[model samples]
Target: MRPNIVLFGDSITEQSFRYGGWGASLADAYSRKADVLVRGYGGYNTRWALFLLHHLFPLDSKKPPVATTIFFGANDAALLGRTSERQHVPIEEYKENLGKIVNHLKECSPTMLIVLITPPPIDEEGRMEYARATYGEKAMTSPERTNEVAGVYARGCVELARELDLRSINLWSKMQETDGWQKKYLSDGLHLTPEGNAVVFREVARVFCEAWLSAAEMPYDFPHHSEIDGKNPEKAFQQKCL
Candidate 1:
């Protein structure tokens, strides 16, 4: 079977299969080399995601994914007392939950490549506008997330990655490096725009290529069509095994 890469996260990941999304870009990039699977859950935080580890990456599974991305914290960073407080997970617990997730995946396969992605910066104005547009009179007066608080979560995610010696993308920092990122990268203060997705895809592809999963180096699951003789097409596939 072709090796698979799993994108495990929250709504950003759940919507990653959408047109022009980062996950879809990865799928296209790794086409014919490895399968890219999405395991995203909308509105989920690390605390809630902890419950899914056992089922998503069964420890006893013989064919564990070769690589997996753990991208949470956006929802976890939701401000307390706000409309999204229900999704808030204390900072310390968020880190702990992430640690648990990484440990679980490690137990499943010590060599599996694990990449952690920090929450992106939040745009209060954009969030407020989105809330108002979506909820009207029910919208909260203040944004449910703030860039400052999201930065705290982002820092925690990076520090945790360092402590665990795993790869990570500091998206919060990266996106902000570019001026006007609020509108350029984010569509709803939190979620990514097409440009934002491009940034993710570029970073992820670079990391995967550096970590020995370069599409150029990976072998296709089936022989190239050029190898098949029209007169005896079966010959080309005779020795191939799934």
Candidate 2:
């Protein structure tokens, strides 16, 4: 049976299969060996995610995900009292929500591996421009999110990983350490550019490889009917897997 790899999160994840995004990269890397499922909801946060988590991710799927990555917090870190309160989740609750999700997944699938991703940094200036253009200058003062504000959530994610003894990738910190990170990685201070996506794909691939070395190198199931002897296609396919 084919293993499943799940990408779960908000808009960033929703766009993960975009041109050079991580989903596509992972799909290409794990072709045939596993099914890469992307279930990203745009503009979602931890609260909304928890409310709908069970509905979105059924525990009883016959082919449960072998690996799952939870990449949220970008929206959860939205300014608390601003108009963006809809997406805002307190840091403590965010931690609780993440732990609950992890526990739920473990309960459902003991063998499933979990990886948590800290939200990437946001460039306030770029976000300000985006807000002005999108919401009009008079409607908004500052963009609802900032790198400093989001860092709290990122820290919570990192801490949870340690507490749970799970691998947590610090995308937030990693992006900022690079030169010109704001321009190179984020398109409008919030979302990932092609370069940012590549980084995510690489890091995720690295984690997956370390966790499941054999699975990472599984051979592609190939040599279809045209290549196989018409009378011996079944045997040929079996040999390929072996």
Candidate 3:
């Protein structure tokens, strides 16, 4: 059976299978060589995610994923006692939760490769302004999530990855390296635009190539359909496939 590459995260991950998304890109790249599973829970924080992990993952996995990307923090970074407080988790707790996740995955499958993904930077001004436009000033309860706060969580993510000796992708920092990255990368201030997805796809592909799969060395399951002899399909498949 093909190995699995799991995508576990929040809204961004939930939408990752959409057109021009990172999940789709991975699936396309792996094709017949592996399976890509997207397990993104929208509006969920680390605390909630921890509860769900038990159900989705076997403690003693008979089939561990070849790789899994844990992308969260966007919802967890929500301001305390604010509009998004329901999803808010303290930075300390967020850090601990991340560690717990890593440990749990490791315990289940020691050899499973894990990638911790920091949430992509949010467009604070753009998000706030959009909220005001939709809900009006009075209806706008709070600046639930801000770029400044997200930066803190992002840092924590990277630092924790180092401490645990796991691979990581700091989308928060990477997205900011470019000018007007907010406008190009973020769609609704939090979710990724197509351009943002492309950015992520490139990074994921890089990791897969550098660490997991060697593109040039790996072969497809069978010969290309075009190469099959139309007059003798089964014979062609038998000879070429083997």
Candidate 4:
């Protein structure tokens, strides 16, 4: 029987399918190996996902899934106008929301492996422009905060993954290594375009395949380890592990 895998996340996750996003690519890549399901929802935060899990994905013995991947922390950083009742949630609260998701999912399947991906960074130039255009006065007042808000939430996600002992895909660092990723991969500073989704989809596939192969005591293909070299336990272990 094919294993069931669920791709769960926020806008980036949502975009994966809409504009030829990674989720669609992943479902294609894993079609022969597993049953992949893309459950992407735009404009959601970690807290929102937790709520959705209870409402949309409650424990159902009749439809058990083998794996789930969570990619949140984008909108969790959204700011309210100074006059609004709810300001951007603090980073600590973001962490708490992540913990709650992890804890509840664990109750459903204690041994189910969960993968958490860190949100990619936004282009500073794009962000500054957004602030200037949307909140002209407020942007001038808190330009620094406006620029650094996403980083705060992204780091919070990284720390949360560490605390939970979950595997994390560091898209934030990976995106930095590429040139013009904002223009190339994303439709906007926040939402990924089709090409951008392809990059992320391949990455998640690599991690998922690695994790699955590791669990099954199977060797990873290609550069992850030498194909023709003698068995090297240390190198194999390192290659398979994050």
lDDT of 2 by residue, 1-242 (tens): 77889999999999999999989999888877788999898999988889877776678867678899999999999997776888898899999999988988887789888999999999999888887888785656867898898898999999999999998889999888899999899998899999999999988988888887344567656765577888767877777765
**Model 3 misplacement above 4 A:** 239-242
lDDT agreement of model 4 with the native: 0.68
TM-score of each: 0.96, 0.92, 0.92, 0.74
Each candidate: what lDDT? 0.94, 0.87, 0.87, 0.68
| Candidate 3 displacement at residue 76 in angstroms | 1.0
By lDDT, who's the top model here? 1
The TM-score of candidate 3 is: 0.92
Pairs of colliding residues, candidate 2: none
RMSD of candidates 1 onward, in order: 1.4, 2.4, 1.9, 9.5
Q: Give the winner by TM-score.
A: 1
Which residue window of length 10 is worst by lDDT in model 4? 213-222
Clashing pairs in 3: none
Backbone Cα, N, C clashes tallied per candidate: 0, 0, 0, 1
lDDT value, residue 20 of candidate 2: 95
